[model samples]
Target: MERPNNVPLPGVSAARAAERATSLAAHLDARHRGQNAQALIRAAVKDLFRGRIALVSSFGADSAVLLHLVAQVDPTTPVIFVDTGQLFEETLQYRDQLVALLGLTDVRSVGPKTDRLARLDPENFLWQSNPDLCCRIRKVEPLAEAIGDFPAWISGRKRFQNAFRAELPVFEGDGARIKVNPLAEWTGKDVEAYRLEHGLPEHPLVKFGYLSIGCAPCTDRVKPGEDPRAGRWRGRAKTECGIHIAGSMTPENEGSGI
Candidate 1:
């Protein structure tokens, strides 16, 4: 087999990626168990950087914490942002502000293949009826395409986000990619403290009770003491839009509606 980095990288087959992802998951799991969660994440990131890995960001409400961590380690790591065309204006603004303040060197915004959307749902009503299919078209497929050439990518999914994420491992294999959720063990308070201490730019909607901000149409504000993610896809049977793994996001008997 060709050396990992020397092969023709872009558009690697799903099968090949799965193989590497499994190996990466094993190595990370073994090495990180004895270390504290934050230390483990930082160590994993440093290993990726030494091997020239790509770091992905959504630049959402919780994204600042991860971005801040990446900036401390390596400012030049390629940071890919998936612009689903449905994000709030505040998210876009925050993305720019954080990149500049953190001195991120290679930030790129990616979107879905143009014709795919036109063919799938010309009226854009797919989100209203079948949000999973809509998100697959808009977010997942494009992201799968964007990260095809990378061995690893980072995410900010904290375990406290929902029941689906409560037992999240420090490292895991997500089909064709090594999905690294660094802050997997962090609570809500941890995120707030990081932002305050670092003096990071906040997403404008955060103050309006919008905790888990996603596409504009699918998000809303939550009431006090409510689940931060309770506002998304309000009144609909959708906890997550299938961006995260299916089993990892299955809603409880409480029904899927946000």
Candidate 2:
């Protein structure tokens, strides 16, 4: 029998959940396609997802633009930050500064389980041998847990940031949840203008040529006329840390060394 659109499916399988999420994402993308970044964020945070959504931020370079928009909408909105335990000290301090300046009330910092780290990466050199696995334990897993209760989440990705994200949509499905990229259509000029207009502080590393900041070990300084994200995972084919990709989020017990 065909289920009605308004009817709820109880105990649906993972496949079914993903299908539903995809459908929801399409609808949302179409509905809010013409809205500006601020308007779109307001809708996602206040109207559409409301209490069931969160914003996952790296608190990296150019993060303040999106964070400022979200703050204007609701300073108390849940913001999930994954502390990979390998980030630059400047990044940590920048996170704190932004939270206080924006008056954000619910900023949660999550990291890998101590037991898992001790067993799988006691030497903390997993990033050297297996960057993907290191990200799985430090970023992907922790973020998955942080946003598990939410049906939707916001990302700070912008199309102008990198070629991989150049065609990013304002709304998309990630596993069983809807991922919103309010600034997907925004350009680099847009971000800089907004930041300066609002007097948003820049990440300290940006001045040192670290345009695309990540962990201290993996990130490097971008040379003149290079891609902003060229500094990430330098000399390696790896671009992302595995958090933004689909199917990267695994079950909590899948790789937990416990």
For each candidate in turn, the TM-score is 0.84, 0.93
Top model by lDDT, which number? 2
Candidate 2 local Cα displacement, residue 97, angstroms:
0.7
Total residue pair clashes for candidate 2: 0
Candidate 1, residue 99: lDDT: 90
177-232: candidate 2 lDDT, tens digit per residue: 78899999988788989999999999999999998888899999999988889999
Taken over the whole model, the C-alpha lDDT of each candidate is 0.73, 0.85
Error of 1 at 200 (Å): 0.9
Residues 159-248 of candidate 1: C-alpha lDDT, one tens digit per residue: 898777888877776655566777888899999998899998788889888899999999999888877788888998788756566322
Lowest lDDT sum, 10 consecutive residues, model 1, at 249-258
**Per-residue lDDT for 254 in model 1?**
12
The lDDT of model 1 is 0.73
